[model samples]
Target: MEVKSSPYYYSLALLFILNLIGTDSLWASPYFQSGDSIESRREVIEFDESLIEAYQADEAYNYFKNVREESAWEKFKHWLSLQWNRFLEWLLSGISEGNFWNYMALVLKILLILGLGLLIAWLFNKYYVVSQKSPPADQSELNLSEDERLIQQKDLSTLIEEAESEGNYRLASRYLFLNILKHLKDYNFIEYQFQKTNTDYKSEITQQDIRSDFSYASRFYEFVWYGDFKLGVTDFKAAKMRFENLIRNIHNSKTHG
Candidate 1:
């Protein structure tokens, strides 16, 4: 061969450097370059073709689309069609006979369809109607209205004594709450009005401690009396104690102030 100088030597040196870097890069042909060209390499996506494939894949839509397809629904439809044709033929034959028996058969077929429809409706009502209906309201809680019926009497002290003597703690709790309201009214902290709700009373009281004490007594009275919850001796005593403590505290504050 001819003696090659600079060109041959430079080519050999370049190849040696590439080999040193690693032989892995040799596999990166134009065909397997990277995933960036994969989308471009794919066949053109036609909307019509994709839509057809999707429709074919949908079993439910296909079931109704191609009526001749062999499925359970088709089997049922085929049987029904066969029965209906047979019935028509029989009916025609019976009509040709010109007798009462043919009319009876037609009437019976109509009745059967109506009965089946009624049965389906009744089954739906039996299972679904109850869940659709709203439940009844609980009668255990009293309604705290704006009516003055809550603080009914002026002389609650006498009523309280009478209720205590009779051992009617529920009645006594009610009477005690009335007495608390009376005290508040006398103190000019709140005006006794039939139109004023419990919320009104709380709003009228500027003192935080008094409002808290009054709310407790008021709720207790409602739960016992209006709510129809029978208060036992121990329950009544606790309620009475709370009311008396609050009343005593209020009395002392007024006296000392």
Candidate 2:
């Protein structure tokens, strides 16, 4: 083959063009170049080592480290304190908001407390004072109304007439009982005394029939008088018959004895 057309000559021509272009110049191009070292360009920061420890020891910084977990009771107390604070806030908010209901509720609570105090004071005065005072031994010295206190001292017939006239059957029953006691005293069956109870006089009677009659009279009189029973004319008549029969029986016994 001719030298101009030979493949060896073409290869040599291509190598010669590559040598002129140069490796250094091709690598130095912007596309192939690298940036400056990252370490060399880095900013240098300097700080005191002691400052790290100082910051760690600070109360604000070390708060979580020093804190201990709360016990159940302490946790409950904390929760309760928070609830109380919230309640106080709510209560005050009502007033601050000018709520009429909240003001009325406060007033109602005050009135209720005052009412409770008054009730307790009244009970104490009524029950305590009554319990502390000793009852008088004598019937004449009893804590009674003026009329009741002088009942036994008055004439039986007059008292009975007055009680019946006034429609005070209870007072009439009391007069009847006093008359029975007076008859018992006159017959020497019993000694009447202002200090003595009806039971005391009943115990003195040796005769069974008289004692039974006296018992019935006493219970009837007590029911009408001390029991504070109000009686109509019909009821008074029925009760009066019992006392009259007892008085007649007592007279019959005294006459025979």
Task: Give the distance in Å from residue 256's predicted Cα in candidate 1 to where it truly belongs.
Answer: 13
Residue-wise C-alpha lDDT for candidate 1, range 1-257, written one tens digit per residue: 99767888999999999896666665565666666576776797557988888889988677566446689988899999999999788656676767898878877877887999999999887545543443233353223451255456566678788878888776677668778887777676688886676779888887778889999887776566655566788888888889998887677655211
lDDT of 1 at 210: 86
**lDDT (10s digit) by residue, model 2, range 137-232:** 445222434333444464777877888898877667777777787777767778766777788989998889889989988877666555445678
Highest lDDT: which candidate? 2
Stretches of candidate 2 exceeding 4 Å from the true structure:
1-154, 255-257
Scored by lDDT, model 1 comes in at 0.72
For candidate 2, the 10 contiguous residues with the lowest summed lDDT are 140-149
Query: Which residue pairs of candidate 1 clash?
Result: none
